[model samples]
Target: MATLFLGLNANAARMDMVDVSNNNGYMSAAEYVSMRNEFGVKAVTVKISEGGTYKDPYAASNIANVQAAGLYVNGYHFARYATKAQAIAEADFAGQTAKAAGLPVGAVLATDVESQEANNQSKATNDRNNAAFMKEIQKFGYRADVYTSGSWANNKMTIKGKTGWIAAYPYVVSGKNWYSSNHAWQWSSTAKFRISYGGFDVSQLNSDYYTAGQKSKVKPTNKAAVKANNQKANKNTSKLVASAKWVKETKTYTLKTAVKLHTGASTSSSVITTLPAGTTVKTDQVIIQGGYRWARQPRFNGYGYLATGPASNTLEYVKSGATHTYYTVKYGDSWWTIAQRNGLSMTTLASQNGKSIYTTIYPGQRLVVR
Candidate 1:
């Protein structure tokens, strides 16, 4: 499930914004509110810096206004020089701001690691410094999350036990998927908005706000617990066997050779394997090794090995009569697709079919096309 997340950088008063010469640099209270309402944004993250010349003049009031409008609020800090002392100061500033604004629901502190100063620390050093800062902030009774680009988070930083606010715009990278134990994802640097500010246009900032939901749905704190539970649940299960015999549904499957294996039962597990189709296996043996469950061999010969190539077949003309219509199941389709195809909402479809969207549907399931 994808949850909408909205991020507002209250550090428009910062020098970087001023230097960008964009109208989004400085915004007024009214403009901010209008933008939030227009975007249906649920959260706003204000920026606090340690020693930056630019400061948010209305940080407190901005946060209050956002919360008053019923949006969740959080605070961030630009780690100038990326030192333990600097991080501590930045964390202190963030804590003070959060306390002043009464933001209690969302994450409290974020380390903005980007800097132009010569004193800016290396990735590892900055990561450690930010971690130190977060540790101190945690002492002040607030949860801290790290804000960095996808590359930095995956390749450079190494701060454990902290949630991540990944910045991966345009097309979200594999590393940007927050489902891998991070808390939130920043999908875009430009998002659409309706607001104007002090000689600055809040609308200009809209371009940087496109992002996708996390791929992995597990929360950071509970990941370990969930993994442990899952491991325990599958402890006795050992190798997954075929629930039913399935033949090659695609041309990629070969005969007799040992193909790649998957551990999980779903398509997500399929991604981690190098398995080919059509390989003959034992009736109750696991065929693939993937994340969650193993692929069980299909029950019958033709049903299991029927090769369906990856090519998409476009059935342009369906029977005009209400009796024999055709529908296509897409990559992201579930019961949701069937409902949408019939011009019905999820609730209506659920009530009519007596089934939830979570109910599994297989390919070629005869659904109402009319």
Candidate 2:
């Protein structure tokens, strides 16, 4: 097992931990060793469950690997409940899944409540639901925390004295006093690391955040690792960029249903505002992320992404003009050929109507072309 050592620069805040989910895929013990030795990571939290039914497939391996690499291992659940009953059920699922995934007793188990439905609820309701969840998860002998954005941590729900894990990504991450109210702050989702596709979600934890036993087992750090860690934490190498695919053509679209506009393409991105149904706007690009098709609409200072519809289909939420044009499938027609003939990319053509390049289109079947 890996052990965390004291930092060389005592004044600089430590980027204490990194959290992972199925989105990050599988990581080996060797990979975690790199995270510890190279990046000075002290702990890891694996996503264990979501809602009441879904369990993250990667949780078990991740938990075992983190322990094998000698890093403190904990678990978190993606919450989807709005009512007390649902919260209890979800909490039970999270606890069971965490135990099954090898998370030891007395480790922290967190509830990640960032869904649009949960965020839209009244504060009283959210407070009640969060309380119910935290209370229920403690039955399994794990400490609990509510994981949310810094804004939600401050404004939306009460933590009931349990230390909260708050996330707020600013363009630049520096200083010792960022997000001082919470026990832990997830400062960067795009933190530079050798693991994963894009970047790791790096967090700074209070010195006492981990259990006493976990902290007691710490090993001493060498000079090189401590120096590298401080430099990276104070000034990360990567800059935040909008994750969207721009297109050459700009088109007008009318919203078929009300949808939230996000600062970025993913649903997990911060919500800017909600646009009502029948809203019309010109979009310069389309981003297919998190199973959704987000249209880049003009905003005051920059652009916001409106989730027009599922990546499989956008016609349900938006149309190009007063009405949409469709084409009937005929003999020998293919998605690529049809898209080429209509001057559209096969990806856009298929995604516009909730179909894929592999979707079977028989003669007389209709497809949205415009």
Candidate 3:
């Protein structure tokens, strides 16, 4: 029994929380780090196990990888119990697995109890087992909850005390549309979008539910660990400031003609990226390559080799009226790559920033992406 969901997302804090299972395909930490930004998620849920001992092999990796990415993490255990004792045992397994897998500071453990096998039992039996699962998981010192279809919750499954993570596809409205109080509504079964390979089930925790879930997760007890997390946040803030400074101290320029930004200092090397005529160029330093002067930077990732002076591209510094501008360079970004990402032509990008595509752009160099 599933209820339809519809309504403007008027309630719930509405933070992006996506759930993934083995069906979503394998994703590594590197992939999660690089692609997680594309989805703008606040939290991620990974399937941990089913029944009493059946574990999802990739659950450990997915949970650990996402937690490492500094996102709020949650784990859900699929239920397949016909009795309270079995439900309790499975609940314990889910809780222990989450702890063993390093499921971040404020992670929730959810009981996914929507299997037809479980539902085949009388509604009375389903209600007892589902409640038992939630209760047992909560006993393990976790912020435990339940996830099910709206119809199941209404007529079949019964979980009254704790929060209910409802999945109501088709009607697919918002958290507020559901009559269930303080519920973390999952409005769809068909994932709305994709991050890497397959789609993911999306849900939102109303502000109250979201905040409560976050607050319940235990904090890192080690002083050093707390300091490390703080340092990561502080480093990002400092990097942002440095990028703003670079924009202030630097003058913007555009390429006057087309030029090849190569992988090495010499033109014989493969082309790293191309700069069409009129591409904005920015560079911190200039180097001589093949008896011709070229703009070079330490952070350009082996790209942006253009002969200096008025011949290949004119070097002119311009100014902007904006309050601030900055773009943090990623691990494998060239000036051309950065320009392409921002939808600007190579010439416009290089010229506006006055940087050569060959500038060695480090992983953290602040460039003006805008």
Candidate 4:
């Protein structure tokens, strides 16, 4: 069959998501499910190697956990070579990494080629090595492909039989532009793939790449025969977790009733805004005080607090990666008192945020709690 790249067609199949990585960090299976469920991610592509030999320290763990989450996975090798000889070696290295990580036959082996550094490589060199990279991986029994940005104009490389994964930032890419078979699109850098301290790069996948469709879609010819097999497989699934850690619903929260924002987690604290019923707010820090639930308004439009009571029943969400929570000084608050109130270390908190333990805090001065 001739090769083709299709974007997400909700009716035809589901819109799948992918993430590429190279040891900046790794997510636990719980972490993966938490983030992926939030965005409906479907698969992940791990960075197995660089050039012909350098390996990603975290690829193995990431692959195992992501697969455990019941997501399809592929492996990729970052190209740094300039010769056919090096290209072939890098391809083999990638295959080894993938197989070692438990990726099976027919998994897509992608080449992440971009213009960021070019690392002083010439176009001729890039094209030659890139083409060879895809070809050799295919020979190793993979569904190989090339990844790049359209702006780089690096389309001169060969991908006639393989897929083209494009990184066209700030655009909602549909894989319709290059070589007539761009199989994947990295739509943006601002979007989060893993919403933790920092997130991973995310992309969308063509159904062809996930047709076997991860575990939840597993199809068996004989249900009676597969039941025993499934029982055995379940015993080995320690590497995966499903859904986000705390996402109860989709992004953008709506208030069920009227609410108020308080300076602190108290109903009697200074009210910043009394949001009417059905008002909207972004999820941020949520705390409990004085028999009520409080949420922080960290954004400009509704920057204040919202409390949970008869008037409002929703609590705010605090991001797990937030470093410090600031507190606006009140008339009687002191450095020591602030630290004591928030359970912060007075000296370390003051110095790190740029202040002194003895510095007199004033009313209205926002200070990082010690």
Those runs of model 4 whose alpha carbons end farther than 4 Å from true positions after fitting are 1-15, 22-24, 115-125, 153-162, 171-180, 193-195, 210-370
lDDT of 2 by residue, 1-370 (tens): 0112226655444557889887565677887887777666788988999888999988999999998988988889989898999999999999998988889998889888866557568889998999899999999999888887655665677653337887765444433556665678776665555433335677877645654345633433445755664565545424433344555537788876577888987767898888888888788887555545568888779988876654322243677775578999999999978977876656567877887778887889998886
Deviation (Å) of 176 in candidate 3: 6.5
**Clashing pairs for predicted structure model 4, backbone only:** 33-243, 34-244, 68-240, 261-305, 284-317, 344-370, 345-370
RMSD of each: 20.6, 11.4, 22.8, 19.3
> TM-score winner among the candidates?
2
Residue 290 deviation, candidate 2, in Å?
19
Model 3 scores a C-alpha lDDT of 0.57
In candidate 1, position 307 carries an lDDT of 12
List clash counts for every candidate, in order: 43, 4, 44, 7
Per-residue lDDT of model 4, residues 152-180, tens digit only = 44433544433577654322232133233
lDDT of 3 by residue, 1-370 (tens): 1221112123322325668776554555654554345334566788888777777877877877786776667788888788888887888888787777666544578887765355447789887887787777776666767787665665666646436887654322322345346457664444332224434466755444543445423222333433343333233222112110111223345664456676655545776666776676666655432323356533435435554431111131122225546788788888768765665545445655777656566898777656
Lowest lDDT block of 10, candidate 2: 1-10
Give candidate 1 regions above 4 Å deviation.
Answer: 1-38, 50-54, 97-107, 116-123, 159-162, 171-181, 195-370
Between prediction 2 and prediction 3, which has the larger TM-score?
A: 2
Q: Which segments of model 3 are wrong by more than 4 Å?
A: 1-15, 30-36, 104-106, 171-176, 192-195, 208-370
